[model samples]
Target: MSFKYMPVLRSRENEKRAFKNFFDNKIFSSNTIIPLIEIIQYSPNRKNTTDSKLPEEIFEESYVNEFKNYDFPIIVDIPMYIDLNSNIKQKYKDFLSEMLSNSNKKTPSKRLIYFNKLSKLKNIIPVVSYNPNAPYPLKTISTQEKYLRTNFNKIAFRVFVNINTITHILNEVEQSITSEDILILDLQDDDYKETKFNTLFQKIEDIKTSKKCKTIILNTPITEDIIKKNKNVQNDCPINAIDNSIVFSYKSFGFDAFGDYAGIKKYLGPDNNGNNYNPPVTYNIFYAYHQNKYIKFKSQTINASKPVVAPSITKSKCWNMYGHTHHKNCPGCIEINNKSIDTSKPGNWGTWQAINIQHYIYTMNDFL
Candidate 1:
C-alpha cells in the first residue's frame, strides 16, 4: 500500500495530561488528524527471553486506556520475535492468543482469536519485529503473517525496522507472507545522528517502492531552533525539504518532552566541564506542528497548600527549561538540579510554550 496515516509515537504518563486536552476538544471540531500512537516495549537482557510481556503489559492498561479514549489508532510494539529461543517463541505465541482471544466465548482457532481481538478493539494494531544483528529466520515473520490473515478481512502489521539492521528492508518486502498495513522504520539514532540525511531517505524510498506496504521512517526528527528566529521566514532560512519528509520520530506520539526519560527522578547537576551529563532526564519535542495541550500542575513547594511557582530567561522569555531547554547551569535547569524547578499549573508559561514547537515552513501561498 502507498500509505494512509501520519505516525505519532506515544509519550510518557506524566506528560500525557497535556495532550489529552487536545483530544477532548476534537470531540466537537470538524477538522481531523489521526496520528499513529506507538507503544514500544524494551528487552531487559540478551538472554532469558521468556520474560517478554504483551505490549499491553509494558504500556499498561491504564495508560493505554488514556490513549484509547482518543479516536486514533494504537501500535503496540513488543520485542523482536524471530531471534527468540524456542521457549520464548512458544511463550509469545500463547500470550498473543490469550490476549486476543474472545472474551465472552471460546475462539474456534488461534487465527480466529486474533481476528476477534482486532475486531473487538478496532483501534489496536499489532507489530512484529525483525532484528538483523542476531539474524533470525525470515520464516518466523512469514508464519506470523499467515496466522493473522487467516480470519481478519483486512489487517495491518507494524514491523519495527531497527536501523542497526538496515539490510533487512529489501528482504522484508520479498519475504512478507501477506500484505502489510504499514511498516515502521525504527531508527536507533541516539548515537548515530550525523548519518547523511539523504542516505537514510533513499533507502526508505527504495523500501517503500519495493514493498506493497506503506513505509514510515522513525528516526528522531532534528529539533528546530524555536528559541531562535522564525523558521517560516523564507530567503533567510531556506526550507529543509527534509523537515517535511514523510518521517515521524518518537516525539510525534504526543507525549511529554520531559518525564518520559526522567520518570520519578528530578534533574541533577552537570559535570566539571559544564556540559549536561544529567542522566535522570529525557525530553521529546515534535517539530512542524503548531500549538498543543499541556497538563495543569501545582507545585507543593510554595505552600503545603498555595499554588504558583516556576524556569529561566532566554531571549527575554521565561522559557520552560524542563520542556524545551536541557542546558545545565541555566536558571530553570539550576532549579531542577537544586530541586527548585517545582512548576505548578498546566499551560504554565514555561512548559506550555516549550513542549512541542510545530511551526510549518511553507508560506500561505504554497497552500493556496
Candidate 2:
C-alpha cells in the first residue's frame, strides 16, 4: 500500500508548465518580489550535508539550474518562509546582486524580475521557487511524471524532511523494504575509525539484514585518530586519503572528483613521460554515467546545515562536479593518460556520481 499523504510525481509537461509559471509569475511581479526575499531570509535555514559550506548565494544559483536540470519539477505543498536579521538580509542582497549581474547571459529582464520577487518574499521558508507553503511542512510529495515524459535522460527528486522527521521516513522506508536496496549513510561516526568499529560493523549488518540496502556508503574523516583506530580492519571502505599524490594531480587542474579508486596509489602520477596522473574527483556528471546517488549525512561546513539528497552525477558536460570538501582529493572522476586530450568534456574522461534512492529502487524493481 502507498502512503496516503505522500506527494505524487506530475507529468513532465505539467511540471515544465508549472515551473515556467513559477518563474514567469516571479518575473511579472513588482510589489511582491522584495517581500519574497524577506520571507526567504527570515525563514529558518535548511541543513546541508557537506562539511564544505558555500555562500548563501549558491542557493540562488541552484534556483536557476533547477529549472534547467530537473524534469519532474519539485514543489512543496505550502509556502515555506524564513525570518532573517539585518546580516542575512544583506547577505541575500549580495546574492541577488550577483545573480542580477549574470542575468544578461540569459533572459536579463526575466531574471531581474525574478530577483525582485525573491527580495519581496517575507517570513517564508522559500520552498524551491514554486513549492506550496504550509503552516508546517510534513508529508510533502515530489511528482516525477513530467521528468519521465521529457526524456530528460536522468531525473531524480529528493524530499528534504527536517532532521526531526527523518527518523520517521527511515522507519517507513525500512518497513516498506521490498527487493529494492535501501542504503543508509549513518553519519553518526567516522567510517575508518576503530573507536566506532563495533558500532559501524553492527549498523552495516543491521542494514544488510533488515534494511536490505545493497550498498551502504559511510561518511567519516580520515583523521589520524580515526586511521589509527582502523588499523585492525583488514578490509575497509575505499579511503580517499587527502594528501595522496593522485588527488593532488587532478586538483591542480579543477574538477573536484572523489571515489573508491581515487586513493589507488597505482594511478599516482610522475610517469616516465613526466606527465602528472591525477585521480578523478566526484561530481554529478560522473554519478550519472555510473547511475548512482549521493546523500549528505554530516555537513559541518555550513551553519544550520541539513542533509540533502541529490544526484551524485549531473548530465552537463560544461563544468566539472565538486561536493563539500570532505576529504581533499577524493577523486570522483578519472582522466585517461593522454597529453593531447581535453579531460573536462564528457566523452574523453570518466567519473562517478551517486545513485538516487528512488531511481535505484525503480531499477531494482525492473531487474526483478
Candidate 3:
C-alpha cells in the first residue's frame, strides 16, 4: 500500500487510542498514512520500586499489534537510548520471530498477517538508527544491515543529523542502503531557518543524485517551547499556526513523504523516575492541524476544586467561531463541541492527545 504521510508516533496508550479510533471508524484509508511507531523506553512503576523494563519487554507490550487489522505498513522503531547490546539484541530478534510466528496462526496465510500468530508478517517495518553519536555506531549499522538482509523486505534506516553531519552520515550509509529501503531524515524540534532548509534541500538533492534510496521521509516535531511561546502572545486564545512550508518545499525535490511527531514533543533524553503525579491545577491545551499548520488552543487554568467544569476554550466565542470554520468534525471536534466531555482533569490529558492526533491525521490525509 502507498502512504502519503509518515506520522512519528510513540508506542503508548494515547497513540494507540488515536490509531484505533481513526482506523475503526473508517475515517480514512489506512494506506494513506504510515505510522512510524517509536518503542519508547518503559518508565518506572508508580511506586518507583522496580527498574524499568528492558527493550525486549517493552517490545512485547508495544501497541503495534493494535493496528493488526489495518492494511498499511507500520514502521516499528527502537529509540536511540536503548543500547543494542548482545543480550538485548538477541531478545529483540526473538521477539520479532515470535510476533511473526504468532501472527501466522490466527489468520489464513493469504490474508495479511494482522498479528496472525502463526506466520511471518510482511508489513511491519523495522527501524535502524545510523546516528554516529549513538553507542557502537558500527554495531548499529551492522544491525540495521542485518535487518535489511534478513527478515524484513524493507528497512527504514534513520539518521538524526543537522547540516554539519548530513553529508557524512549520508556517505557513511550509502554503501549499506539500497534503493528499496526508506531513509528517514529526522530534524527533531529544530526551529525553522532558511539557511538550514536550503542546506538540507541540497543534501537531499545529493542523495537523489546518488540514488541512495527511493523513499526518503522528513520528520520534525512541534516542540512545547513553540506552543508556550504562542500561548504567551497577547491575543486571547490565539490560534498558533505552525509553518509547514519546509515540508511541502521538499516535495518538489522528489521526497517521498513528510512526517512530524504528531503534535507530540520529541524526547531524546533518558527515562525519568516513574512519578505520575497530577498537578492540582492545569490548563487544557488542545491541538488541531489545518492548512499545513498545527493549531494549539489553550484554556485558562482549571483548578482541582472544580474538576468537572469544561475548559474556558470550549466556552469562549473564539472556539465557537473556529469550530464552525476550521473543525473537521473528527472525534476530537465532537468531544470539544460536547461541553459535557470535560478534559479539564489532568488524568484526561490522554483523551485530549488522542483527539489532537486523530484530527491531525484526518486533516493530513485530506491535504496529502
Candidate 4:
C-alpha cells in the first residue's frame, strides 16, 4: 500500500524464508517495502509424477495461511506464463477479501485512524495480466476485468510493453482499467535507451494526465546475461555494480515506485508440462548485496580441472576484502559471517537465496 519499492518474489521456499526472516529480524520497515508475490508456475519433472502440483493447490497449501503473518500489504500475481484459470482467479480474490475483513475486525481503537488511512490503499492488491498477443486475448481481459469488479477495492494490472507498443496496448485495454488501478510496466530484460526512456516517460505522464491510471510502476530486470558477462571479464569473484539510474530517472514523472526481480533473473524455465531434466554437477555460488551492487562469489565450476574448497561466501576473497565493510550487518550477513551454515545442501540453496534477498530488501528500502 503506497510502497516505495516492490521486489518481485516468486512463491518459493527461499523467498518465503527471506521475507519471514527479514520481518522477524526487523531489518526494514514494512511501510516502505511491499513485496509483489508471484505464484510460480508449476514445472513437473518427468521422472517424478508426484512432484506436480496445480497453481491453485500451491496457493492453498503454501500461501493462504502465510498471509496472516505479514503485516505489510502484498500484491499477489499469477505469472504471465501460467494459464489464467478462472477457478484460481476467483480463489485468490476470495482469499484477499477474507484477509481484508479479518484485518478490519482486528484493528484496535488506538490504531483505527492509521488502519483507515492504510485501508484506503487496500491491504491486498490483485494483479491482472493484459497481453494482446496472448491466446484468447479478449476472454483473458474479460475474465480479469470481471474478477477485479467482483470484490477488490483497488487492482494492479501488469503488461509487458515497450515504447513501441505502449500506446496500442493502453488503447486496447483502456476500458478495462480505471483511475484507481495501478499500472505496472514490466520491461523484462530490456536494455535502457535514453530516447526510448524519454518517450516511455512521456507516455506514462500522458496516461496519468488522461486519468487512464493514477499509479504507475516501472519494473525491469538485471538479466543473467549482464551478470554472466561481468563474471567472464573478472574471471575470479566479480563484484557487479548495477545502479538504479533508470528507476531514479522516472522520479521527475511522479511515478509511484520502482520494481525489480529482486536480485534473481526472471524465470524463463520449462513450462507446466513435465520435462526430462537431470541434475548437473555444479558448485554453489554465493551472493552478497551492498550499495546497489551484487558481489558474486564463484566457486569451482563442474568442469574445472582443479577444485576449490570454498563452501560459503565468507571464504571468498571478496567477502574478506569488502563484504564485511560493504554489506549490511543484517541476519543474512551475520549468518554468512559466522561460518555456521552450509551453502551446498539442496535445502540450503534456499539459505543462500534468502541471504541475497534479505540484503536486497534492506538495501532497496534504504535506497528508495
By TM-score, the better pick of 2 and 4 is 4
Measured on C-alpha atoms, candidate 3 has an lDDT of 0.54
Question: Each model's TM-score, in the order given?
Answer: 0.45, 0.23, 0.71, 0.68
What is the TM-score (0 to 1) of candidate 3?
A: 0.71
Query: Any runs in candidate 4 off by more than 4 Å, and if so which?
Result: 26-29, 41-58, 81-122, 131-143, 162-165, 172-179, 209-220, 227-231, 235-244, 252-254, 268-291, 300-329, 340-348
Q: How do the residues 257-328 of candidate 2 rate in per-residue lDDT, one tens digit apiece?
A: 211211111111122343324333321211121212222111111223221111112222211333223112
Sort by lDDT, top down from the best: 3, 4, 1, 2
1 or 4, greater by lDDT: 4
Ten contiguous residues with the weakest lDDT in model 4: 108-117
**Model 2 regions lying over 4 Å from their true place:** 1-170, 186-191, 219-337, 340-368
Worst 10 residues of 3 by lDDT: 109-118
lDDT scores in order: 0.35, 0.26, 0.54, 0.54
What lDDT tens digits, residue by residue, belong to model 1 across residues 126-216? 5554444454554545555555555443344444444454455446544662344555555432322345444554554555455544555
Across residues 303-364, which tens digit of lDDT does each residue of candidate 4 receive? 44332223445655556544444444556556555433443432234455666676667666
Residue-level lDDT of model 3, residues 258-303, one tens digit each, is 7876655554322233333333323444443334444334344344
| Cα RMSD (angstroms) for every candidate in the order listed | 12.9, 19.6, 8.0, 9.4
Candidate closer to the true structure by lDDT (higher is better), 2 or 3: 3
Q: How are the candidates ranked when ordered by TM-score, highest leading?
A: 3, 4, 1, 2
